[model samples]
Target: MASFHFELVSPEKMLFSGDVESVVVPGADGDFQVFAGHAPVMSTLHVGVLKIAGNTNAPQRVFVRGGFADVNDSGLTILAEQAVDLAEVKSDQLMQDIRDLEEDVADAKTDAERARAQAKLEGLKALQLAVAH
Candidate 1:
């Protein structure tokens, strides 16, 4: 199968950089997949798991807090706020983090702030569910 270069980076470090057969990204609007010769695009990502398929040990699933995805002449690049490999994400720790986010939702001062916090909480909930499988 043909492949394309894919890179996933967070503030701390680059989590992945290699050729991939395909990549499923959680776009702000919805989930989308990219393949070789895909049209160039810039998309804002939502909190969700990024699925990478290729010559990997197993299908890679990485949790991304939120980020931007860019596909250009070079390849696909993900600039994530925070990212963790599903295999490395501890369920207990994730639940506790969600609890903290729930508090933020409750403590939100403005309607907009509350909405934002709620969205983030929802994303985390979705991530937790994905990691379960």
Candidate 2:
């Protein structure tokens, strides 16, 4: 299979930089795959797991909160708002965060706040499901 350079970076640091066979991104509109010679495009990513293939070891799954994916002549570059490798994630902590978010949603004073909290809670739940499998 053909490979292409891929980079995943966050505000804190660079998460990944290497060649990959494919990458499944969590685009705001929907999920999309990038290959070695994919068409040039830019997309806003939502909260979801990024599936990466063609690495040295097993396929990787990384949780990304939000970001932008830019695909050009060089390769694919993702500037994530936040990202964490699933392998390094602590289930206990994730559960705690979900619990806290639930409370925030219930205690929200405004509709906008409630909606934001609810959306985040849903995103965390989705991440939890992905981590379980």
Best-fitting candidate, measured by lDDT?
Answer: 2
Worst 10 residues of 1 by lDDT: 55-64
- Model 2, 1-133: lDDT tens digits are 9999999999999889999999999999999999999999999998888999999753399988888999999999999987878998799999999999999999999999999999989878877887897
lDDT (Cα atoms) of all candidates against the true structure: 0.87, 0.91
The estimated TM-scores of all candidates read: 0.76, 0.78
Q: How much is 126 displaced in model 2, in angstroms?
A: 3.9
- All models, RMSD in angstroms: 3.3, 2.7
lDDT of 1 by residue, 1-133 (tens): 8898899999999888888889999999999999988899999998788889985753399888878999987779999987888988788988998999999999999999999999888877877987987
Residue pairs with clashing backbones, model 2: none
